[model samples]
Target: MFVLPDDDDRQFAVTLARGLEMLRCFLPGERMLANRDFVERTGLSKATVSRLAYTLTELGYLRHDVEARKYRLGGGVLSMGYPLLAGMRIRQIARPFMRELALQIRGAVSLGMRDGMNMVYIESCSADKRSDTRPDVGAVHPVLRLAMGRAWLAGVGPEEREVALNQLRVGVPDQWQRYRPQLDQAMRDFAELGACFSHGDMQKNIYGIAVPLSAPVDSETLVFNCAVMDHTPQARALLDDVAPRLIAMIANVESAAGLRQTVTTTPPRYPRR
Candidate 1:
């Protein structure tokens, strides 16, 4: 294998991301792991795993059982993540509905919420006929790439949406600018249309349509979206059909959550492009 002499500098970040991926390898089930056992499952070199394990332990994100030489997620992980998870309990309520939508549309469905300047996918369900593009459950996608981001942006207050936009601009690579104007226009259009759709933003040949979940009483600022890369001759028609259904779904979710069950069926505040 040809290795660059300066690869060590680049290696540190890759190692950190790898270690995080290792943590995810252990899902909600199979909660514990032994050193020897972990190495085999993660496919990471034993030495690297050892060092990474020690680092995680120190950070309180992972803990080891001294006697069994086994490891488990540290309480620290929960400690750091509890409140966010608590707030996103909407996932528990929205999952079934999202599943229903996916079944109805024969597309991938997702329920999302805003976190800082990004749209976080709390739940996603892929239809049987459409497979291969697997989006990790907790993964976050840039707002400019998909309808989820734009839809949520439309619903949030200006302060929040602007801050999120600034953050996104900084986080994304500079090379992605060819689509910058288009994204800005989408955001503006979403504000007017009360929803958003996209083609080839995050991935080539992929398409998405999204709408802000109607906050029950308060009008939630987050979005609900559906994406498909499977196969479609008329992506636009499918997206349009999905929008009204998405609005009603959000209304159901907000009412169930008791956070905002009185949102007005107000028309989109922005002008059509």
Candidate 2:
């Protein structure tokens, strides 16, 4: 669930936050949602949901479906994202490399950054054109569960990392309790293995290895990952081959983007848990 700002905050706009939160009710893979759906997802009153939905539809942020009595994200929502994507020179610089690596490993390679308590995919490349399993751009995954998110959590400064951890501990206690051990292991893996691994954890039959960029991009922490959808015995052996390749790729990206002094394969140091 997306968290909203406190209503009492001096700078917080209550009605604006409510409308935006209503928009966030649409999850990935969902095409349309009715007012009742928003109410259920957001814990808002039926009347409030309807009002916000109508307002969003009128403002061009949502498209109304008269026949279905539902709404889908509109062009205005998509248009807002273009500027962000266009300004990310790293995304443009990393795509070709991501494509090459995706082809090499016959898997999917992605670049992502933290968004609140989740990691959102900014770019993704898949080895198979027809594969539906690979995450598309804008896909969000829990930070405590997936390799990409774990890499971001592992790469940040201790203070920022602790703040996020505290948020998780308080914001989503059940998830934090369930996945805490895996989070600890991820930190150790980053410090010792140079990459973090997630096998059949975040999603079933998925294998992933991720490493954070050696340096921040535009003051944002970025993570690069390779993911394969497989549950066979061969998946175990993928770690060794993919880890070094991912590290090499991160070094290349950091060098090309001028985010580091020199291209080095040494992993970023993570705080000992």
Local accuracy of candidate 1 as per-residue lDDT tens digits, 164-199: 767666655462375677677777667566668787
User: Residue by residue across 23-99, what tens digits does model 2's lDDT show?
Assistant: 77778889999888888877888898888888888889999999999899999999988899889999988888788
TM-score of each: 0.62, 0.88
Local distance difference test, each candidate: 0.67, 0.82
Tell me the deviation in Å of residue 265 in model 2. Answer: 9.2
lDDT over C-alpha atoms for residue 264 of model 2: 53
